[model samples]
Target chain A: MVLDPPLPRPMIGRLVVIGLGLIGSSILRAADARRLAEVSVAYDAEPAVRARVAELGIADEVASSPAEAVKDADIIVLCVPVGAMGAVAQAIAPHVKPGAIVSDVGSVKGAVLNALRTHLPSGVHVVPAHPVAGTEYSGPDAGFATLFKNRWCIVTPPEGADAEAVQAVTALWTALGANVETMTAEHHDLVLAITSHVPHLIAYNIVGTAADLEKVTSSEVIKYSAGGFRDFTRIAASDPTMWRDVFLNNREAVIEVLGRFTEDLIALQRAIRWEQGETLFDLFTRTRAIRRSIIEIGQETAAPDFGRERG
Target chain B: MVLDPPLPRPMIGRLVVIGLGLIGSSILRAADARRLAEVSVAYDAEPAVRARVAELGIADEVASSPAEAVKDADIIVLCVPVGAMGAVAQAIAPHVKPGAIVSDVGSVKGAVLNALRTHLPSGVHVVPAHPVAGTEYSGPDAGFATLFKNRWCIVTPPEGADAEAVQAVTALWTALGANVETMTAEHHDLVLAITSHVPHLIAYNIVGTAADLEKVTSSEVIKYSAGGFRDFTRIAASDPTMWRDVFLNNREAVIEVLGRFTEDLIALQRAIRWEQGETLFDLFTRTRAIRRSIIEIGQETAAPDFGRERG
Candidate 1:
């Protein structure tokens, strides 16, 4: 394994990561790999997950409870599902030390920021962040130190939030090799609703629709999937509980963006029915430029089929 | 480069491929690499494409016209887009050798079979096939000899199509490392509408929807594409003319499948609006199983994010 270069100074004094799943375990691994924090601790509501994390040896300590995990942390990141953000914040609020920066890796920002502010004590700081990177796999073993490397991490700090705390959170992500951008919680929700949440919902919905087809057998769908359907299945295979919570928590933006998607799909359907070849061709050509832009920006691979191995 | 094992005997005495684009060029390359045909000839309406095919030296001879290409060939495969299939078939009809097998790689089989039957001479056997594989990129330079390796190629021969001709087409694809399955033309259209055509329509529609969003800037979508939107963009970037033809020729099945997709998406939207977590979770779980089946059948990769290179 390649070693990361040592940092000039540790970014955080004591770091606590709650919820030792994909994102949480990745933070612990990255912190240890880069020595981003002087001391790194971990906790998960599931006793089994904590035990497995201890076995992975990614954290300096795997705390048995949330209170113990945050008692000495200078920065605490809640990495649980969005629906559980409120309860996880409330559970650790009482023991969180003053001047600590509390952050999260939730997909939705507005609801998560509200949850953090509502439950946490006033003296502590809350700087919510979302690393827009992941694989279909989940759980502790599914993560690696470079999971966030070269990916975007949007930090949505509420207005009038502590500047120093925001800087510390931004520095942590930068040290982990992510490009950091700051925005309002509400704006972050709207942006992600288009870029991530609605896209995922569409993938899940199509796969579900394919599965329920009476004339088409599931075996046939599976067999002929490489034709294009398989790509959607990869994202549809992501953690169901996390995605469920994302939709429930980011309800407004998701519904609004989904409305746009439905409207566009209806127009495309009409074009098909009316045999409007020029209309279909124009939209198809326009969409290709966006893909080119994405590849040029390094957000996506230029390789075909995401560089999937060919036989 | 690794060499393909030589075939016991050439599958066809002479093979002519019309429309030297991605699928056509790939056929030429695979035929030469595996020695599937004793002599391979090529033709394209565009002079530039024919010149490129000659420069690549993939075909034994690059004929200037469809008539010249099929005049002496034993098996002729039309590789043009679905919209151009009838015209290409008619152009080559008078010159096609008697007792030769006329086949195609069009995505939709029923309409193509009809086009071939309507235009071609009675002595030549007509069989329509679709190799369910491709990259988003198009044209001669985008193809490789192994494009069909381990992928499924569905053969839809018209009723009472010559048995010997059907076997020859099957043998040619098998020699190029494809697993061949036989079905009726109508069934092939329906199966592909769900597994390939409709999925591409959804991908194209979503990308179009995202582009038209005033709330989310294109730059933001491009920069944060790693958050799931990029996958749809890959398919959305496919050749516009090719995809438009697919929806047009397969209109009946595509409209039926797309109707199902829209219905399911609306239900998902309602579930999100009502915060129906269990409903979302259940569908997500079911979709994951389809992905697993596809991987287990070797139609998809088991590696995370299609084994895209990491930083």
Candidate 2:
């Protein structure tokens, strides 16, 4: 079971990651660990986060401002929330290098692509990516170097975008141990709506419903959560502002998928009401195959209860 | 961090487990590991499962028939589905010894309590319990001795039941490494409906919805499931027959909780449709505290992603 260390791949001359949150700090840490870039810089709007990132020493240099962070960088990654993509692009536009590739790690690609295109300078390329990986915890302290390892990193380059820029972005994610996929922004949004966005919305919605129950005490819900409700709580515990922006920016796609979800749920509710055992059994049986498929593709763990330690 | 071994307590002279599924097999394994019962016997309706249990060697004896299983047992815990509880109870009623205790590990307490009380002999005491623990995988091979370790085992004794019989059932669960809680069958049903039943229904419902999407391919859903959909798939992958019986038996509580869930979801849908960022943020923030409480109380793991090994 002995394994060789990953060889350092010095792809970019200078890499700057703005917004030192979970994904941001993770990118910095992974870049340092893998030597994906020659020099790495970090910046965050919050002075406290920038100081914390500096203290953690994941980045070679902690920049004081968005403009300063991107001024001499070959690639600038905007890891801020989806809603803040435009403002961060605008803030860094004036100082960004002419040939620098401007990228983002937003969940919603369509809005983020439009935001980056409208704000960044003409010579600067825009490449938006959504890494299909995360945890419930957020912030710099919650991140680690292997967050993207063995995870999917989806790149949604705008139509008629530069190929070299796209390739560079893809290679960076690849060197950082991610399986990269490229798709249109619209397609990416629709796919993520069913796969990620709507799931998170429903999880948050269910947790809220459970918290406000009058017949059941909150303590009871918390105590017996191992049954199933605890899983939703984990997803619902994700960063609030980031998820808020995801729902806000991707409203159309989220609403469309959610409508379908409610329609299917209503049918299930009717089946439960009518005591249709066969219908429930059939749906329950079919869902197991999807879980198997995800595990087979190495997208999820096959361990029971996610390999959680039992006392 | 050295810990002492759990002290063995011989609580029951002869224990018979009638279903050999996940919960049933785990009970036998835990009983054997802790020495909670002097002799543990097992029987499953499915011949294949009974043979597998014998091969696993978790029980002292694998009985061939219902009569043979419970003929001389001091405590018989029926681990069959809620709908099958009565039939299993009735099958062994004529052969059961007088003054023996009959208990069950069914998920729905109220219906199971009713079924056991109606089918068991007059002198046999009925005490139904539901351990609020399990994995998505089921059957004999999917279970382990520590499945119930540090988990909650809720006991719902029939009204005016024998005091010694209730104590015996509670002591058995405690000796098997579970925290025992006593409550009325009605309250247990209500609590579990929110915590387990409805959560499972919605998980099954959402996975079905995602599978039926036209714009998003099933392969895409499986590839990008790590966002949040994968968590739901785990719950949805639970045993179909067991869950079908749970929804059918706990129809009232599940429907009531599901109604609240839909109402809350509609409000959330409206908020998203109207771009209410603050509304989403407020609820998302509040849900994080419940997750913290569940972890604090030891019902859930504090590790990120349930401590799944990262590559």
Candidate 3:
């Protein structure tokens, strides 16, 4: 069967994806696959990544410097770690062409926007974006063209910025197979703290706890991980440098949600000690609905558990 | 491209999958797909479950009683929760044909073996197994043939058990595409507690806490769950009955691991509160290695965070 091609978006005259890591590379792949841009260029700090892009032919051009990559590029996307955003912004500050829309794919929005906003030159539109998609893997080698298909790409427009630029970025993401949503930077940070940041931290924390256990327990953790803990291990296995930046950059939001999390955990501990089965069951049942919603929203594939995809 | 047809197994064999559910049904799918048995039967106390098995055509025959299911069966495997093992064992105690090999897919082995050893009649060999697999989904409809494929299936046979019976079960799982390992029931429980039970409890606690937050934060949990908490939610959404049974059956191991986890968590929490970057980064880096090991062991698929395998 001949497959229909992805829809075209003529509004995006030029598109450039910077960083070329998992998120950036995925965006490059998706945008290129969908033909969303007239010209798609990828830039990465690492020479190997640039060599990889050349090998895969994922983009029309590969640049080593942020200035050279963003030059004459209508849309520039920053996909570096949250902590690295400031330096990237500073380096590219003087080089950014007028009217060029600058956006990012950072997990933490408020801090990133704050960092980049202070570094940007006037007339260069800055929109902070958080694509609610990713895998446990990292680097250019671990990316695919279909990674963003049907995932969310949130665009947080700064106060009094160009509406047309925000819309254009949103349009570009939509054409790349992402559902676009606009949110306030503060609100985006708060929401992500609970959903993404806190969870990663907790996964990392628990895995650390397991690793630090007595030798008998540590070995047991690895051997019998199939039950549930192994899932956390997979998430916790994410890049340490990236995650450290995430925690340090998104400090307030992470700490706020974490404070609430520790309290709730202690309560559950109390309930378990008291053998309050009804409380446990009630919470378990309520949480089940959220999972159902995730499936219904088409964010998840139509497999109970994951057999439909894995098998 | 044409698919390769599987090699046929020896016929004239009878198989009974006791307590048909996610794992049991998957085993049936694998066995049936491979033509591993001439006749396969299933037993479940829930009439609805039995009817569903018939609806899915998972077995050649559906039996109302454990005794009926095991009658004339060469292999009888239990797939019930850990807590239900004793009752199931006693119910099938009087009806098992001589020389029939009995096995189980319970999570906590030590207690389950203890229960079965007390109830099963002599001459019926008990070979307890725990396939380090499963999804959050439950019931017969949730099963798939490839659930065990490329996953670990640990077999904990008692000392001096019949060699042929153990090998038969091992061969059966091997045919189903599982890598099998043998360990004592006591060791299996301890390992699972650190790897599966404690992590699950932590996920449930954090998700529950996030859910119980003041309205604003609660909504944020759902909206931004793309960050990290959503991973926890997936694990937290597992069947409450199975989890409850897990805690009760593996009380000693779970409690011991929980103690260690709490201590480590407290230390981390102190570090976070005191703004100790070195301490947090050190622990975080150490946990990353475990994640690498999981991938190295081939337990994980090569997908980025939420975008890897669809669940």
Candidate 4:
């Protein structure tokens, strides 16, 4: 007994998920499970990943290369790291069918679009998508069908771009159970710079710092990491290639936000050094509100332990 | 039903958990559920909290003052913030039953002991305990009986301290399923300053900085928080009063570790600004091992989405 009317039948054609890593493989599985596409093809450079593609049964077809993956695909998703997007775009541009739509699952959309704009053949639609969903794990085997369920997927379509292509990509992600939002690439970079890149970089930096500490033994760090450092380590443990490309491609926005972060951190350092309990308390209390808002938006879980137990 | 022989139970007459906050209430619940103690009493300074204490039906007895709570208790646990330990100890010391045990749930052992040592009666044994378990939430209702399960509890007993009292507390925490470890006060402060205090302070600082960014709106921060800052906000949102006391009490250790953290953060900041991909990748990769160790120790759970599913 359904309370609401049934959802409309989704509109999607042949879809391709590039660089079959955690996100890529997950999207493939998610699309197949949701029946979002007639055919889904996955591609990766590494032979092992490609071999695992056959083993996992994620995609209907496994392509030899980026070009092969998008040869006849209507919706081509560049699921590789930001650093590899340029080369993959170059390789696939020549083979992209006319009227075909191209999108990506890259973290930084602005850079990805910029890299692909020159190589992409005319009349082919390009919509940069960032499925704001991932895990600490990587590689093909790490993916699951439920990865994109109820997550946010930001679609950055170029100004005055093909409306149909945008609609097709949006529908594809929507069927995969993601709430899609469209924004300008520049705005997306700036927003993501604060929300994703800077936070990840900070986590990486803190964990790196902890690792390099001379006074504290690594064993001690691991044993006593039930504290705040463990959370950073979790974030810091994400795929290195993905993060490297993220920082490289989103340089300007990352730097700008990082400047703000550094200044704020220094101010906090001063407060701690001076024993300013009021400032610390005020900041701590204020951040709690932000967490609550995230929970409200349904971007983060409301569980007390953040659903770690189920995971 | 019991495959193994029942573990020997220590004879702990009555345990009073002062301040029905996250730690206190949780300890009371866990102790009572495990039948680790004959009786469990809870106390909070605020009448509202005391009234709610009765409402929760967790404690065998609820009291508004430390003196009333510890009056006839065999073990009086000061579960209040580190800053308030002195006052709570003073009020309860005179009323604590002769030969009773006095302990704490504060992070910093040396400071808590120093703060409350002078206030205790000659016969009352002081054994400082720091159970390394918590969430961002606080207060009586936030506590759960399983909060201390599988967590680490560091106990620091003074020289010539009552062996029986220390053993009883250790046994009780063990019964509650916490892995108990004993260390000197100085060592405990140093370890915690790095593992908990410094990391928490850094998290609070970073989140505050993110909140203050003018170019990036709070809405943007919350919307895109899935990348990494979300984890920091969770850690930073921990009780302000409790953390303030932690930093204030463990000044030297916190300062020393904080200095190391700042130096490391600066180096990473430089690397990011310079777009040094190798350095970032190398540093980021090394942190993964620590995360694996944490998962192995059962301190953290590995997740595919790391709690980004709700949104």
Top DockQ: which candidate number?
1
* lDDT of every predicted structure (CA atoms): 0.91, 0.90, 0.78, 0.80
* lDDT tens digits, residue span B1-311, model 2: 11125455576899999999899998898888777778899999899999999999999999999999997899999888889998998899999999999999999999988888888878888988989899999999988888888889999987898999999999888877789999999999999998999889989988999999999999999999988899999999999999999999999999999999999999988999899889999999999999999999999888998898875
Residues A249-275 of candidate 1 have per-residue lDDT tens digits of: 999998999989989889889999999
Per-residue accuracy of model 3 over A76-145 as CA lDDT, tens digit each: 9999998899999998888888999999999888889999889998889998888887777789877777
* CAPRI rating of model 4: medium
- Calculate DockQ per candidate and list them: 0.78, 0.74, 0.40, 0.56
The fraction of reference interface contacts (C-alpha pairs within 8 A across chains A and B) present in each candidate is 0.85, 0.86, 0.50, 0.66
Residues A93-198 of candidate 4 have per-residue lDDT tens digits of 8899999988889888787888889789887898889988788899998887766667678999988888888898888787777788889888888888887888
Candidate 4 regions with alpha-carbon error over 4 angstroms: A1-10, B1-10, B306-311
Interface RMSD of 1: 1.5
lDDT of predicted model 3: 0.78
Off by over 4 Å in 2: A1-9, B1-9
Candidate No. with top lDDT:
1
Candidate 2 is graded, for docking, as medium
